[model samples]
Target: MLVEDEHSLHAINVGRRLLVQLIETCKELENIHRIYAYVESTNLDGIHFYTMMGFQRRETLPDYFPQRASLTPDAVKLVYEIGNDSSTEAIQTFPVTNQP
Candidate 1:
């Protein structure tokens, strides 16, 4: 889920497309129920992006990245529950702009 900084892929909806495809593909599987990700607490932009993509904040994970010597070592857990009809319907209605 990493994109090169030089490319500026965010402006073109790359992340949105990837998440949509992932949800769509996972929805077809009977066992898949939710998609979750841990983002550094200091990463405000990352948090905003995921929230905008329909993920909800689950909890704050303390010492999530012990190896990293950062000011904010805690991580925020985000989850997108795809097991219910309402969640799927929300995904289907997400706005995605087609960029050439």
Candidate 2:
């Protein structure tokens, strides 16, 4: 559900901040231990972005997205585990080498 306009500037880390807030809210209110997202295999940029945000690729679901079948044959499932000891903490503290 987190999406930014393709034509907008992407160097501001807006998506990252929003995603972090959502994850924190989910942990606090929903008691959700993990967050999952499905991205079409054809979208290498999407996969890379999520991976940079600390999501790990779990597996590829064959023909997972029928709607995108014509454009992409499969979907990749990714997971972001949340907790005090979760590895995703690195996402918060990792230094941004380039500041816009």
lDDT of 2: 0.63
lDDT of each: 0.66, 0.63
Q: Which prediction has the highest lDDT against the true structure?
A: 1
lDDT of 2 by residue, 4-91 (tens): 4343556777767777887787667534566777777777777787799888989987876545324565778887877645333322
Q: How far out, in Å, is residue 96 in model 1? A: 21
Candidate 2 stretches with Cα past 4 Å from truth are 2-5, 67-70, 84-100
Tens digits of lDDT, candidate 1, 1-100: 4433223776788777878898888789766677776777877777787899888988988876655443466778888888745433322222111112
**TM-score per candidate, chains pooled:** 0.72, 0.69
Model 1 residue 29 CA deviation (Å) reads 0.9
